[model samples]
Target: MPRRLTRTLRRWLYIGHRWIGIITCLFFAMWFVSGVVMMYVAFPGLSEKERLAALPDMAWEKVRLSPDAAMAAAGAKTFPRDLRLQMLDDEPVYRLTGWDGQRQTISASDGHGIDGVTLDRALAVARHYPGAADVQSIEMVERDQWSVTARYDPFRPLYQIALNDAAGTRLYVSSRTGEIVLDTSATERVWNWLGSIPHWIYPTVLRKDNALWRQVILWLSGICLVVAVSGIWIGILRVRLRRRYSGGRVTPYRGWMAWHHVTGLFAGVFVLTWMFSGWLSVNPGEVFSSRGPSREMLQRYAGHDAPTVAAVVAVTPSSRAVEARFVWLGGAPLMLLANRQGRKLPSIP
Candidate 1:
């Protein structure tokens, strides 16, 4: 190539490197810091153990309706996505979850449907927790700073109950089915201030709208990916390995520029992987499949043979269970008995 043309190309590459680095440096810094916090604290979510622990001991005597009866009450014409038999306010209840954000809770005694988390009902739920002897405050919310993610969208109009506990714990209950969707204590909130909240640029007003939150993250990550790639190229060129100074010194400049170059050398790969993976996380394309069975697969599994109310009215479980949930497999209702240890194999009908 001509010297003049080569000089012009180099100048443009330098411009690209300088501007892109300035544009993406802060986000890269945030990602590095927040990733460490995420490794330790994680985002606030309800673990299965915690959710089960929050409930009162199972009153087996309260379970009059069978698993099949619970499924029937939810109007499961073919097969439901998921079903759980739980105790709500000392009453045996069945929570039926289906695709496309469908949720229903039915009485396990007589199959009466229960809906919505009224303020009074929310207080009743708070009492189920051991530390929550008395409810201090109840906030009727659609979405907030804590519950800003799209995963919380299905459980709209959540009831955030502050339990009077040592940890200053808060429980978020779904108004749709009156189920405890998330639990957060003082420690989680303190750690997450440096974790998920800033890492994902998550805020109530922006994240409550699912479409916007996704777009923001997707586009931001895409831009950052470009910056990281360009930075790698510029670093490779600037790094000298032939001269005396080149053996030890990779960056020619000192101060912030050196900081940028040296840190970029060490951290550039992480920045690239994180940006690319973060974009991939949203899965702008159908690169990966979701864990749940597809609607068609579920329909096929329950094909021709529609589920009927099981004849077994009484259950004589061998082991003690904190709670029992039901699931449909091969068009038959299967009971999942769970205890403090974990869930046992689904009891065959």
Candidate 2:
């Protein structure tokens, strides 16, 4: 009975390995090739340098309202987490951000709140990009393959403008604030089809729903992991390291079968480790969930239970500044200014 049970179990192992290996072989090839492509090109995004370079200098002379008035018009009840004054197209606007991630844009010229950006405004914003050529066409995109990530949620309903420049650059302008949220070149879009898109299993339909995407990755990697383990086990059972085969060979198989058996023995550990690591990437069962700082830990880091910033009445900003930032540091309120070059101007207390 014992010998019969052993033979039955071995047969099942072989069957499991062969079938699962056939199923996951495509995924393995895709991941290996796409991972290499990813090393050269990353997903599309707007860098700080690109954004700053595209912005027109702040026209302080056009400002008829003060920072205090702008904040009040934005309905800010307390000192906001972030406040910045920058140009929106040709007019100056103040962007106020709350601690809970809420944002409001207020016009500095008339102290009125900005409701939404028009198509003409979006086109005007796009023209400011360096080396921008004649406009090819503009399409309204709620969410597409390049802008499917959650980070672009705040800037939904984007205006995708294609420029006729040599680079075939496409710029995404937020319909809410008229800010250029992201830009992608022709080269970036083409390479990413084989790079981050496939490597991350990112498709517009799949990635739009974050929860469903995570589940898909988890299940696919889990099944592939089972294949890796079974392959290693079957390889060990078939390989003969000490005892020679019929022709004094370590593996009884010939041609491709021999190559596979011999290499599987030597490379099994690496393949298993690689497959296991990929499974862990999605943090299955919340095994790798972040243990971020608690309330107590945050207080300890800040050296205080709570730190507050007092709203201060300010004069008109100098003409040299392109942007102004309100921040509280070391329990003191400060106003930092930045020029068009992105250099920090003197801070005012």
Candidate 3:
């Protein structure tokens, strides 16, 4: 190749590489920072005392009911007005809250006079019921404090509910023991908002809505990959051309460019792999689909014995219900269960 043609090609490659880096810089920075925080932060859990303190503040004359009676009162409220009961710590204190509706606090121990109104009923009524609203379970961490969480159908617009109402107010509850740990409505509001800022960037936002912004990021990354690959090819062509003209003697400038070539040659493969993986993480279905095996298939592969197969299968009906079985495989107690299919599963050694 001629000197002028080589110079032109090099100039184009440099421009492409520089632009791609610049475009992805902001998204890359946000992803890096959020990933670091997620690695260290421990999410809060609930307490018992906090769960007990959430009883209704109504007068005895206005509401005179026991803990069981109060639960019955809340339960009778109807659809969109379904009463949710939660326990705090080991004590049986309940947080009475409405879904797609208002919430209240009631004593689970006595079911007496209303403890207090935690959420506004009118606002809860205005909210739409994307699906059935019912509390399946509640956990207590501290006295009068609890974490009340519920899950709706997958096709439902409402995904799940998590409340940490300890003071009978809007708070954050601990997942372990339905106890209020953080006053989320007050001082912690700013931090909660700040935590969500990273969702606007690359992989996070791409997963939610793959619009023009996401496509642009992908295109820029693809360009970078191509530039990296082209850099290696250019280096090889230069070496071959030099050897043809100069009888196999490589110049110092050619050597420096060769180093750049070799670096790009090796690094290009890893870089492409990273980009592709990142893309898959953002657009999962585009790369792979999920399909369940039939009962016959499972029996054929797993085992023909019904009792043996049932023993081997561990069904996690919900996130809260976890089943563990110990099997002595290779003289080691091997614990097995289905994993979050898409991600890498931990090694059992």
Best by lDDT: 2
Once all C-alphas are superposed, what RMSD does model 3 give against the true structure? 14.6
lDDT of 1 by residue, 1-349 (tens): 6999988997898898688778787887887898889899977889888887777667778888875787777777754666677678678787777665688888988888987657777778777775775685567888777887778877888888898788989999888777788888899999898998889888778877778888888888888888788888888878777762543775687779888877888789987886787799887855688977878877677552354536353354555666776555665656767765566656765
Give the better candidate number (1 or 2) by TM-score: 2
lDDT of every model, 2 decimals:
0.76, 0.80, 0.38
**Per-residue lDDT of candidate 3, residues 208-319 (tens digit):** 4445555765665566556556555555554544345454554224566557555655666766676666666546335555456643443344332111111222223342
Candidate 1 least-lDDT 10 residues: 304-313
Model 2 lDDT, residue 5, Cα: 100
Which candidate do you rate higher for TM-score, 2 or 3?
2
Worst 10 residues of 2 by lDDT: 304-313
Could you arrange the candidates by lDDT from highest to lowest? 2, 1, 3
TM-scores for all candidates?
0.85, 0.87, 0.36
Global Cα RMSD, each model: 3.3, 3.2, 14.6
lDDT of 2: 0.80
TM-score rank order: 2, 1, 3
Structure candidate 2, residue pairs in collision: none
